[model samples]
Target chain A: MALKPYIVNTGIITAIGNNTQQCKDALLSGKNNIGKPTHLKTHWESEIPVAEIKLSNKALADMAGVNEEWPRTALLSAVAVKEAWLPYAEIATGLRTGFFSANTVGGMDLTEGVYREFKETGTVSNISSVINHECGAITELVAKHFKIEDFVTTISTACSSSANSIMMAAQMIEAGMLDIAIAGGADSLSKFTLNGFNTLMILDRQSCQPFDNNRRGLNLGEGAGYVVLMNDKAMAQCNATAICTVSGYANANDAYHQTASSPDGIGNKLAMTQAISKAGIQPSDISYINLHGTGTANNDSSEGKAIEGVFSGNVPMASSTKSFTGHTLGASGGVEAVFSAIAIRDGVVFPNMRWETQMEDVNWKPVTELQTGIAIDHVLSNSFGFGGNCSSLVFSKS
Target chain B: MDIYIKGTGIISAAGDNSEGTFLHEPPTYDTDKLLSKEPNYTAYIQPMQLRRMSKAVRMGIGASRMAMQQAGVEKPDAMSLGTAMGCLQDTEHFLAKMVTQEEQMLTPTSFIQSTHNTVGGQIALLAGCYGHNLTYVHRGHSFEHAMINAQLYLNDHPTHNILVGGIDELTDSSLQVMKATGVYRKANSTEQILNTNEPGSLAGEGATFFVVDKNPSEGSLHIKGIGISTPEDTAAAAAQLDKFMQQQGLSNTDIDLVMSGWNGNSSGKEFYDNINERFSASSIAGFKHLSGEYATASAFGLGMTMEIVKHGAVPAHMLLNGKQPKALKNILLINSYGHYLSIWHITA
Candidate 1:
């Protein structure tokens, strides 16, 4: 028998708030956290506006209750994982649990300083600074900090990373390889990633406006998000209440370009359609959508076209919460997944903050105001990445 | 569902092809860098397309093409790739240019290719495969995660042919940084590498791909099981290995040969020694003496093990104990990357 995976708990830390409930409250209150940078020290700090988490590295470490000096990515991951794992604290000890995290720019935020110092002084003062430089190193640190010693690993596929992590956990649970899986991703603001996005000319000077007529580019942000998924047997044994069921998920390659999506969004269309089929549902069954809206010219246009192709003329209510928490790169999928679960659980549609006009190419409009008392049974979330990696996930109410 | 390795391709310090059973001569190197021997990539990729690809992408596409051609698969239905440090050369290129030029006048090529999934995406694009595409970037378990994902994909989509691979490259800046971190030793030759009890190990890079499917073709090797864990000590690691073998219904004595990952480093010597003692009844072989050490070095080890099982023979230089095994029907391959241990069960 194939096991159905359910989201029993969730944790998230973004520019808007620090936990799932806080994020939901921020969404309900029409609070946007995108603003000029104050924490990240970069050359463009005064010029560009980003949705940065309003905390220093020291503050984050203190909040995470870690005495050792750690990178911002690992610190954020520890904070989110702790909140997500709180409910299953006792039962997880003897269960076949796994931790699957997605991360990019792992410790680059710290290593950049070390590299610069080495260039100037020709010597590294502390080896610990570069020890967590690898993408998996962040996951390893977070896992060890949380005392999660089973099946810990990391995934990196650009922005779609954590979506793939959740999908992989679902598959593993269905195959009986794991009873419960904690899946999410973390990425912190680093000059390497900031300059990388700036070189592509995709960093907006102003706050981003996703799916809008005059949308220019994205605002790079940093944070973490995670969800705890359990099989039916594990759920029963733990006597936990599920927030939603991870009904279906699919991944497809665009095969178009290295960084650009196709004009037709073929990969996006295929992923959404395949995921819908896997869930055994019709397009009309989808009640809401958490768009992968980075507000970049290419992403909005391509994802809008893909949305039109998937839902046809009558599209479901959709919004991009990235307006509240800028494009978080690798952590965007996990952030949006948590938002989708909240939308399903609370029956509310998050507003696409700062939207004025519809896109020129696609004929659709996002929900611009917080919608309450709506019936949201099934939610579809999309996360696309560089190299044309596209993924879609369907979360249904439990 | 049963997964079969239809074909394999590898580019390592040994050579570019996967037809041979032995490393004729150990690759000689004075420095810590053990770069892969380049093949004629023009045979697989066009010059126009090759101009934009980095070393990792070129090697990955070339290896996938060779494996697909040998497996009689024109286009695989899916692809899953693994890498610990992806496209390091391009990443360093972009990062240096960004810093040196003050983040001005930059092309998107380097930044785009620097992503970890670029290699797998390139393989899918070249093969025109729009099916499932995934990339795993776990540290030492990267290849193992890719293999496990391949198995799940085959189980879910039984008719789909999958291309699974692990690719990593060594660059100058990365080498400098790693050497500073004391990950690369000053040892030179294979003999010195084995004799060294230093804290650091040698560095190597390679790209290896396999065409996997549910249908068993002629001369295809059957994959028995794959298990990965991160235990605190060698005793726990040995217990994990035992549990994995027992899950596959095989005892330690049922193994004809044992392939271990022992890179002349004192960091993981105890773990390897424990494995050596556990598989005492079987012929023991080591590969890191030839392949050097890297996060995905075990991928190259697994490829070589498959070749050995296919030929039913073990090279004299690889054996640490006996001359020959009665038969290479069942072989156990184990690798310990720091605290992580990966076990693979393969049979002819």
Candidate 2:
């Protein structure tokens, strides 16, 4: 039996835009949505810029067509998924539909607000329903609301959670177990995440600059991105426009450290090598690479080394779009996946914003200008997260 | 299509690994309570690494090490793990510190260790196995997802040995919050798990690991097939099981033992009862009584099934039915986690 290819129809909700078109437009224009935090309140608001969705929880809830009491994380997920699935709802229905989503800090925004109240007064008031903040709860909400009755699961591999989710969905589809899968991730900014990253001393007080010598750190962002994957049969029946085919994907652990990638990028090299092999393509065939440039000192340097190791001196045109979107954490993979599909569909590569001096460690430069009318074929996206979770996805023009 | 369970290990509130856990009587839980014992993780983990790992990682490492050692493979072809809560204790710790410390001078250790793939990544790192590595964190069906991935890897590659497991740990804050939200059983309930009328089940945590391969080792249990279904899809699950058995040219009667995830929660137990009514004639056993109710408790069941198939003997304490099959040939392990039902068919 031949392995089935899993294709992505992505939906996105971010500070830059609400749907895929808006995100594409934002990327093409090199618009950065990083600014003062609006939806969330934190003491660091004055010091750091974040890519926050301007809508309030109530507004987002209404947008998702849910009750007012839904958690912000669930609301964001529903909105992104709604947009992603609307075009393919007919195809999704009556199939072996599975929901595999991920979020780093699930429902923590609600929990933080409630904890504050509980701390102030012994009585926990209207925030009583915020208790289903476990890792799988958000995906459960999306699966239940969408009436997806097949294999529903959630991934919480921190920043790389959604990438791993997408990878798992593809593996399942390849195994001929499920017909369709909605795989992606969502994460709303919480005082919890903001503060956690802040405490780690990795948060930049200014805008994030990836692969730059003077880069400070990452700017946190909140949003959700989802991709609807279908088997060939479902695709034929739905006649869905295939934006890009998930030609190759691989996940490997660095096993080097808890939070840091190995200096040699062994895990990253393994993942990239495996993915290229799975795609039945050579490293030279990859035209564009979406680097997991978190703008943090550790990530950019390590990822640069990994890229160099994989492609040697003959590197593909690569850039870290994180300069525009910041590090979206769990949603980064899905978001970048959307960007990757757009890159392939439009045959254009978005420029990496805010690059100044090159890193002294490894001599790698990001695509600095929007290049159009290029014969782009395959785009490789990398997402490396804490716990040495490293993943690479190869997307090709359909 | 031929997969084998060459070796297995488990670390739960019940005990440390398969040898330590299965050799003794099943551990009993207090009514509507979670397990509270902390395993001596230092036995398996280095001190420096142990300093950063959370309970989930510790349990996972302990069980994974045991599985690798028992399988007599220094390094496996691949490593995979399933986790629902990931590292909640670490997540919660970081969250609390973030709020209390006002985001100043925060160490990255907890934040770093709090990912869902830590177990799988750590296992691969410790074992120095650079082969395929992945983590599945879908709730209720995490272990099933991992198993499916393992099967796929086996199908595609000629590699023989694979390490797969599921690990979930309960934190005090998570338990407290779950209790407050009515997802946990109320305190002081005298009702046994299966007989309980309450809506919630007790919370628990553990890790279970298996050394799987396409070719059977000296003492191997054949992993015939695996089936999974989303929440409340018991009919689909049963049908899938039936189809799997039929494809394997086996029947319900051919199954010498059925290990059910009767977690004492109303819904979980109800699902187990449904399976029981369908396979009442088969010798049925339960593991939640020993492992407690967590997303990956089914992993404990898998570990047990591997042992029963290899040893040709069921632990007396795990035997729910007095009738013991003279010689174990086929065993069915069923578990419902989060919102999915997973069935594993193993034959000796």
Candidate 3:
């Protein structure tokens, strides 16, 4: 048998909750955290609702046991990675490990404050505030925090960033470059990203209704999610228990627009088809799909059509969890990957929150109710991002 | 899996894609930041695409196109890229607007272009080929990591050509911020880059793309090995280098030349000193003196190494110690930035 990369552990903190169990419970309860922002100080606070985690930077720092000066993104990453790493701490040491973090607005939440001060005052008060301004700073911070010095890198492919990170880690491990890999992404709410999405008219005013005909746009959310991956040898050597196998993954570009998917959904179709094929399984084998439904009209119709094209109207059960957690951008892939793994591990299909009507242009409607007792042998998750970057992954029960 | 450097495209302070133009008369920068010598981007990018692309994206696209053209390949099976700062020009533009405008009435152009993967995404979009797309953003190891990914991908699919590259651009605000942090030398020329004896090295930016394939194209060089490590100190770094060489079945005498990223700075002196002492049997050379210093300078160094490997000769200006090698068979491009070390062994 081919060497299979398994998800040995997972960690997540989102608007829904701080751990996998809490988030899973909330998903089944059909509860959402999307609401008016209490912290992110943007002018559109009154106009747009976000799924902001109800915690300050100081509070998160305290939770992560770090100084409050660390960027919220890094702090959130630390919290999530700590949870994921604790179980494998003994085996992780002295192993050829690699950490691949996915993030877009890295450290911007902190740098923007200092930058605004400098723009007005003509000098930054403390240069250290902007030290972590780049995207790799969070990865560096998290890697150092865990003392993981084997291999580390950051990926920033917009919404698909973390999914690609997960894919890269599996590829590296399969190539014998790393024995174990920690793959995921983190992003914190910031005026930069919020306003950026707002400018594109993609920020919904209320809770996002993904896959619904009346869906307007996405509700920007923030958090971090990670998974520990190990091959068979590493698993046996470390005595780590497998959560689920990272069966297959593929990344493709739409080549359509910078921020929009193609009308034909060619890239989305290719990603799903290729991922299913690489899993050495047929499309019918995908038990559930965590759709990249950001509640936008373009995304729903395009992705819906792509599913139709690839699955041939016999599409399996699917839902867009973004309705519950909001669109987390770079971290969305990691968050949804965790959900997919859990779906395969626990045999549950999480619901697509706040869906009423299906689109007229599409042939299938997403699962709107909490599903249980489903034999979810394989779960396919899709994460499409800006610049036409799209990725899909298959998580199978070990 | 045997990986070959089928083609190369580079845009830096040295010049555009041609090695002749870059090696003959390299541009000298008196400013703290050495900017790239741009080509007519309209040749590679259309107007609609050009309107939204940042300088980094444009450079990345231009270099990738030239590389694909040189390799005579219409569509690569995959595209991988690395950028340490990643669209800094657009990032600063969007951040400045977000601050000045108080996050209101901002345009989405800069925001869409600010992502680190914009270049890789754009390259795929331009080519309409997206097999496995990835972008690495680890400080000094960005390009090295991307190359590593390319090798792994080739190992899986042995009959695929991959476009791999590194790109980063310098912006005014970014330079100013670095200046405030004391990361760039204020007054330095390209000639003084090696002997500045300064506290900080001059900042520079460019993009270099390569077409890597399993089958060796005509006149292409083979990549024998690649390794990247973040060591605690000089001792750990030396051990890692030794292990890397041993894994490749190579010794000091087997390497004909050693290209070191010896940027003129006191911070990197210890690492350079260790390299100079360790590689006494090889012809030591330097390239940051001509291309300046940047996070992905190793990409430029790779381009330079390929040129030397193809010609079997090394230019006198790049020689740091020992005469030019009698016959260039294998060249090791070694780059160290603080605690990070990247090694690439190129053989013809």
lDDT of 2 by residue, B1-348 (tens): 577887787777667653443545655545556563556766678999788777888888888888888888778888777887788888778766766766676777777666677777778778777676777766777787788778877777766578999988887666766676666766533237656666777777888888888887667888777777663465655676677678778777777788877666665554567777777678887777666678888888888777666566777777666556655777888777645677777777
lDDT of 2 at B265: 68
**What lDDT tens digits, residue by residue, belong to model 3 across residues B260-297?**
98898887777787888777878898988766677888
> Which portions of model 2 miss their true places by more than 4 Å?
A1-8, A91-94, A116-128, B18-21, B26-39, B102-105, B186-199, B231-250, B266-278
Residues A1-398, candidate 3, lDDT per residue (tens digit)?
45678899899999998888888889888888998889888788889999989988888888777778888889888888888887777765667888889898888888888887777776788776788888888899889988887779998888999999999998887777788899999999998888888888988888889999999999999999999999888888888899898889988888888889999788899899999998889999889999999999899889999999999989999999999889888899999999998898888899888889879999899998888987899999999988788899999888
True contacts kept of 1: 0.75
Candidate 3 Cα deviation (angstroms), residue B330: 1.2
Worst 10 residues of 3 chain A by lDDT: A86-95
- Per-residue alpha-carbon lDDT of model 1 for A255-364, expressed as tens digits? 88778888989889989999999899999999999999899999889999999988899899999999988889889889998999988888899999899887889999
- What is the model-wide C-alpha lDDT for candidate 3? 0.85
What is the lDDT of every predicted structure here? 0.85, 0.78, 0.85
Query: What TM-score does each model's chain B reach against the true chain B?
Result: 0.95, 0.90, 0.94
Q: Using TM-score as the measure, name the better of candidate 1 and candidate 2.
A: 1
On TM-score, the stronger of 2 and 3 is 3
Provide the DockQ value for model 3. Answer: 0.74
Candidate 3 backbone clash number: 0
lDDT-based ranking: 3, 1, 2
